[model samples]
Target: MALLINHCPVRWHAIYHSHWTALQYDQQSITYQQLDQLLSALQRQLLTQINLTTPPSMVRLACIASNGIELLLMQLLCVRVGWLFCPLNPRFTATELSQRLAVLNTPYCWIENEQDADSLPTSSPQLQIDFELLLSNLHEQASSSIAVTTNISTSAITLTPLLIEPEQACNIIFTSGSSGFPKAIVHNYRNHFFSALGSQRLIPLASQDHNLLSLPLFHIGGYATVLRTVIAGACIHLTTYPLTVALLQQHRITHLSLVSTQLIRLLADPLFNAKQSAIKHVLLGGSAFSEEHLTALAARGFHYHLSYGSTEMASQIATSDNSSQLQVLPYREIKTHRGEIYITGETRFIGYFRDNAIHKIAAEEWVASGDLGTLKQHKLSIIGRKDRQFISGGENIQPEEIERVCLQYGRVKQAYICPTKDQQYGQRIALFVLFSDSTQFDLDCQQLKHYLGQKLISFKQPDHYLAWPLKLANNQALKVPKQVFLDSLSKQGLT
Candidate 1:
């Protein structure tokens, strides 16, 4: 029998313990009862802190920490207390982090420790708390006889656990911001609840399943996995990065979420043998999958599904069926206007949070996804990002179209096409490729150009062939920052 999700509304008599495992990290496994106990205790301490300073509704808890039990618990605590949980990427450099914090203008920021807080540029005056120390204090207080409940309740707290509404804003996620500074995307509890339900319609999650927390909590995919597990009463295995096949087998992970880069690394890992994997279902997203990667998974008999989504829609808007055609998932609507994708539905985010307020989307307004795609017979095929399309010699050129052909050439491992200023064509295509091997191919630029000519029209063909940028070649990010490539081109006098 499945365990009950504590977040769901329930009758007073229906609340019961099931002893089902809720979380597993390393050797420690936390059951549903234990998880509820921890959250319940943490709630009082958190409430006391909030009541002492900011009201719960006005609280914007911006957290900078790695993925772990502590981070996950904080997310749950925010949900229970009706605070907007803003989890920033800890891997970002100090400058990057400070810039993001400035945009948020958040009232409170939580860091792992004092060292982490000291690293940031203190241009803004926001309350910074040591989250690890806060957790330790909570643990200490829980063991003490001092009644913390009265500390918060006696203070005339404006927010209470019972007051948390599903319609209230709950999460703030920053976009990748390949072109500019990341936008703060806000999601309500209803968005997440429907996102999980929509994904469950295509990808079934059972109580017996153990999903690997492969993605970070900063990304929508990672947070969605948490809720998906909760809604299914399943277990989420929280482990460190570089997930090995041994760990998968050890944890008995049944469901996995991965991006294209992670999938490639796994396929290349000498320790990875597909037949030995305990992973039954793999959900792929983040970017477009190459034909090479797809063929590799297919040959290995991997039951992988492709997903297309964004932070605005919560997580997955469409999931691939058995035939691998992306079909619109439940609770989300996808339509094309002049070949550009527009989205709206129950799972759509509230809006972009900025300037200390939510810039909400008008009711029944469709969000322009900035993605160009084609829909045929209820199946969607993503062409490319609309912003990435450039005009060359009065003809439109989509880099993805050329990149797709380059990947099909068999020698290219990854391909990216960017626009460069051209004296003759106004804007010309520049192709950067990562060969299957790190070394350059025997075929020179002329040969590559000749090959592309056969596959693409002369106007769409790249005028410049260059090696992949060194900085991005080693990037572990799910999506390559296109602006970085533009910078590289500027340095090389190509733009």
Candidate 2:
């Protein structure tokens, strides 16, 4: 399929005519024509005030802004100009942003807040403009100028759209870095295209669908949703900040991508059952969903597609359809190499940004995912992380298996198993849990121990239990970084 982008200005104008609409925070809507004019003016302002070349270069364009129509337009402009777009999460601290920008060697940085621009490091060359100022300036320019003619090509700008190949580095996405500092994973346009196309094959979304933009655009889940929508010629309903069940009902969202924790919270809400009929598919990933939670959702007549994906692979490797059975996509080829999950095919990323020395793909062009799993009957079942397995009493203990078992209990919402230092066993398992309804019902620790003892071998059972509030890290919406939880345990004098 051809890329759903128009190169010629007149062709783009004709193609996008009456095809776009902006859903603002206040529920106000703007047509595609208005959005185009706004983007044209913004593009002109960016060229004039931001010291950007008339047609931009292949240099990186960084932006830190809240979720809005302007941010979306900026991204589109970057794509049109063939510039690498790096969107920083608005939640990042100044220190974190500075450190990342330094490592990325970003020449341009756009900030929505003027104070943030003033606070930027002197060594970095940045032209920060507030969103309000940009919009106001564009509005003022529109009043004075009769025509806003954009020179798509300029001598100063050497970069052309076709010059940047599909394999060329496009975005640098940082991992959650719960273990250490975040690593910038380089992904190309081909990686994203294949990922979106592969996912579309599994879910079968069309132009009639309205995907809810619940996840943060900075993350792959949120970013992929946007790309999928555009590629499918569908509409996206954007929420202001935090995605809640109420917003889902208000927008009457048909499709949504959510983490396991978010799904659990939505299931707990009273309105979920009443409004769930409108939702056709909820793509669940980021972490493993408990069997009990799955059962609960099933009971509510809610449909879900359990997906397994990572940032390094763009988004998803395997995703289930409405049938509730996991289906691997055509572009993705999955196999088990020495009990470790290795994947290859079209959707894999080019490489990481920092470490060019490290080889990302195996001999067969398959990426050694570090995750351990088995393929049975052509279906993949992830066992756990091979590196996360601990030797206990001369036997290997996989935390994921124990956690999966704990999830069978209806009281347990989410569970994680970690190994703590043990003098005799070398390492013993520790269980961290988040209960679904902790106020009225709770999982008995003794009962869980006995239950696991009957199901799993003695070495696999957790030696201790800790109940805490679970929050997914900001970087990637996948796994809860075990290292982060371990640090928290140390801080509380529990480790």
Candidate 3:
């Protein structure tokens, strides 16, 4: 029988997998036994600070760090004390971070290093905490605890458990908000519990598995990995390193997750040998999978699970295990109402946070997912997001439809179609193509337009073609900044 994830999986792991490897970073590994002691010390530090200022329940914490040991430790410690943990992307500029933190409403952020401290928004209201200082204290505690723990190998260390109810907010995950402004998704431990249990149905995990931290902790994909690892009592391989074939082989990773773009980078690498690797499963999400990429995955014999999800739904709403057909996870109920997806489940987030208040998304039968998908054979196939669909020349045009056609070709590596103003058509499709063999292939406008004409309808064809920017060459992340594309088009007098 599979482990039905409870609200307190961390505690369950502590009791059962005490001597098992719980976490690993660059030359650092922590067992569940050591983790219990570290959690105890951190708990005291957390309570010490809270008791000096306010009640533990009232104090919330956020983390601003790149992927590392400190960030992971704090994530566990925050939950142990029932303090909500908000993870911020290190790539965000001070301006971007400020805008997000303003919406998140000052939750005492923990900076990973002095460099991050310097990058803080000048003249912001958010309180900053020193992660290095806390690490120093933890080291001191570890020194004393190791000797005491060496003798008592077969026992459990008593931990101060948090009073975390099912509905209590435990995390705040900010979305990419590709449609609009990023949303601060408020989530409880119950949400993570359900999300983990549901995803396990598609990608079954075991206690002996080692899952790599492939995605950033700030994103829901990365956050979900952490949840799944803890619930399964599996070990997590942490790294500041990028996701590479060498890294996977070196660590002997049993499972990992990736975005389509990230996965493409690994597949494109000539050194990557799929047959020789120890990895058993790859959970792919973030964006749509192209036909070419899918073919490559199949050829390499990679066991991959495709998923469709959002931050508001914790992680995945629907998933497929190494197949084209997608089915909803065990915990969530999904339905299509007028071409848009609606979901209702235990995995649903509490709400969005802004202006020192909670803007809750009511679960009245279902929550509108802003995505359009069709169900055939009792399986879901996504067309696109409802918000991404736009009209062109009196016909409903989905950019993804055009993009899908473009990606079906042999040479094209990336496809992005945006709406540009057109007086005659009301709005026209602006296509941007990035070729795989840039040196051998000709990217002339007339040549590519003629190529697209053969595969697409007249109305569905892009009115304008964008010159691939040289700056984005060989970049792993396929997304080109919108403004960059628009600005380049204007300079060429195309818009």
Which candidate number has the best TM-score? 3
Task: Please give the CA lDDT of all the candidate structures.
Answer: 0.76, 0.66, 0.73
Clashes of each: 0, 0, 0
**Evaluation by lDDT, superior candidate among 1 and 2:** 1
- Sort the predicted structures by lDDT, highest score first: 1, 3, 2
> What are the per-residue Cα lDDT tens digits for candidate 1 across 41-120?
66665555554566555678888888888888878767766788899899889999988888778757778655777789
The local lDDT score (0 to 100) that residue 276 gets in candidate 2 is 54
Tell me how far the alpha carbon of residue 457 in candidate 1 is from the true structure, in angstroms, after superposition: 1.3
Residue range 144-205, candidate 3, lDDT tens digits: 76753653355454543324466667778887766688778888778888888888887877
Q: What digit string (tens of lDDT, one per residue) describes model 2 on residues 427-490?
A: 7888887665555423466667778888887777787777653453222345575666787667
Model 2: CA > 4 A from native: 1-17, 20-26, 49-57, 114-122, 133-168, 178-180, 274-277, 322-324, 355-364, 376-378, 439-443, 469-478, 491-495
TM-score attained by model 3: 0.89
TM-scores vs. true structure, each candidate: 0.88, 0.83, 0.89
Q: Where's the lowest-lDDT run of ten residues in candidate 1?
A: 9-18
Rate residue 109 of model 2 by lDDT.
Answer: 75
